[model samples]
Target: FADPSQAYDEQEASQEEERDGQYFEPVVPLPDLVDVSTGEENEQVLFSHRAKLYRYDKDLSQWKERGIGDLKILQHYETKSSNCAQTIGSLPI
Candidate 1:
């Protein structure tokens, strides 16, 4: 009887070679994108720190974690107003 495992191995090797020989082109060529402004371009970062944020939950009666992010304090050049910016990773708790 033909070995089933050997057949599978040969099939896998053929598939790998087929994949290596294949050349795929994108259906639609993507154009280069211009940089988008975040409205803080005129501001300068005064301080930046990585912090974990938490919020008090009334129903759960405990502090739930908000997220871990880089907290930045920025000062505008003209207005000299300080603005806080946070970049968080993970889902909201």
Candidate 2:
């Protein structure tokens, strides 16, 4: 005699499997970075990875690293001043 709409559909499928097991699934897997810049109050972003450099803090959201080498020599320094003005235009101007 215990039918009552199949016991309220098995108590709403056990409260939707306990709200899908209270989700939370980060077991490492984040670095594929390559943003480049943002900060200056835009709340940080700056990533690069591999050749190093990473920021994305944004009030501690994550991805901190920051600094090592070759973020295209830190986001292009005019290609090292255009290779030092082509080595001073072959020396002469």
Candidate 3:
């Protein structure tokens, strides 16, 4: 007879594996970037693998870069839910 407890463990393990692999699309690492100001909404992350520059003034956001240099990032987006403490712990301090 199959052990019920063992089967439960196996099922849990599979679920974990599936969840981990669900985010298959890799995000390009831009460790040097950061969001300088505090806002109710988090900064956005663009898919393009290039740095962007902009000027901000009380929600007056404008792109200053058109393939210009000094594309260092001032903010990076956090995709995971804010309620999930584990996800935030993984982010850079």
Q: What TM-score would each prediction reach against the true structure? A: 0.58, 0.21, 0.25
Off by over 4 Å in 1: 1-32, 90-93
Candidate 2 has its poorest 10 consecutive residues by lDDT at 81-90
lDDT of 1 by residue, 1-93 (tens): 999999999999999998997889999999999898777789999999998888999998999998899888999999999988788863322
> Candidate 2 on 7-26: residue-level lDDT in tens?
99999999999999697889
Best by lDDT: 1
Model 3 Cα lDDT, one tens digit per residue, 1-93 = 999999999999999998995755558855777767534256443322333334455565554532323221333366543321111122321
Please give the TM-score that candidate 1 achieves against the real structure: 0.58
What ranking of all candidate models by lDDT puts the best one first? 1, 2, 3
Native-to-model Cα distance after best TM-score fit, residue 9 in candidate 2, in Å: 1.0
Clashes of 2: 0
The local distance difference test score of each candidate is: 0.87, 0.49, 0.46
Model 2 residue 21 distance off true place after TM-score fit, in angstroms: 8.2
lDDT score at residue 76, model 1, on the 0-100 scale: 99
